[model samples]
Target: MTLRIRSLLEQVPDRLDQERFETWLETSALRIERILSRGHATPAGEWYDQPRDEWVALLQGAARLAIEGQPEELDLAPGDAVLLPAHCRHRVSWTDPDQVSIWLALHFASDGTPQPGP
Candidate 1:
């Protein structure tokens, strides 16, 4: 086997018309991805409800997240992280317009173990 080093903050474009998602790693039990956003937000009345749990960290810039049934949105800055359990509806409410916002997200089975193949 060989080893390679990569930076998460590199290779991003200066402008983006829409958010970008890149899968960094994937296995039967887990998936890790990098998401780039610039002034992006989920459309009104839309939410993401996933079958697996997701843990996300803010690596650059700033953003706000809204979880269904919550009265207030979450404001995230660099180094902040949050975990959304399976079926927990959520959306990106706001992101910095002047700069790119980088997010690292990990998705896994709800029980934190490998899921049976379908």
Candidate 2:
């Protein structure tokens, strides 16, 4: 299914929506996911560790994604996607506060495996 976004003011002034990291795939073989949300606030000094690399795409709305040590900001619109180098540290900075974001995340080893590394 295609990701879709809708506009509505976010509840938190610092956040876009009520974020739900609905799935981690941290336990599965293929991917991780952030379902309907305004956005996610990963800790400043912490990083999300997956056994495999990840590819995240904005299926619905716009998002501001930031890699921990990178100075660049990622502005993603619907259909936009990013590939996180394995073990890359990053977090979601903001989402379109006026809309709910639908994201699809996938994780896989560099060896071309469709699922996470064994």
Candidate 3:
């Protein structure tokens, strides 16, 4: 198979009616995704409880994240990142309303370690 080269920031959609999620890569125990958000947030009284650990980085625009049991919300700008352990409840409080927010997320098994690809 021929290898392809692509740009992560290219061809972004003009309108984001809802949050966009694009899977970049995946293995048996790991997955990588690119997310685009425009003034989007998790629903009130709802939280994400995932079985795997997640590491997320903000590449552009801005966002706010709230972790369960934490008093302060995490304000993220370009280049900010957070690592959430398995089952750690969290939610997106807000995202930039005037511009699209770009994010890179890595999801791995519950062990909090990245398994090597075959």
* TM-score for each model: 0.92, 0.65, 0.90
lDDT of 1 by residue, 1-118 (tens): 9999999999989899999999999999999999999999989999999999998999999999999999999999999999898999999999999999999999988765655542
Against the true structure, candidate 2 has what lDDT? 0.68
lDDT minimum window of 10 residues, candidate 1: 109-118
Better of 1 and 3 by TM-score: 1
What lDDT tens digits, residue by residue, belong to model 2 across residues 1-118? 9977633322213444357655544654576665565645555666676567888878777788778778898888998888887778777777766667787787767775455432
lDDT of 1 at 106: 99
Expressed as tens digits, the lDDT of each residue in 1-118 for candidate 3 is 9999977788787679999999999999899999999999999999999988998999998999999999999999999989898999999999988999999999987754556533
Clashing pairs in 2: 8-98, 17-38, 29-116
Task: Tally clashes: model 2.
Answer: 3
List candidate 3 segments past 4 Å from native. 110-118
Ranking of all candidate structures by their TM-score, best first: 1, 3, 2
> Clashes in model 1: which pairs?
none
* Model 2 quality (TM-score): 0.65
The candidate that wins on TM-score is: 1
Which regions of candidate 2 are displaced past 4 Å? 1-17, 23-28, 32-34, 112-118
**Candidate 1 accuracy as lDDT:** 0.95
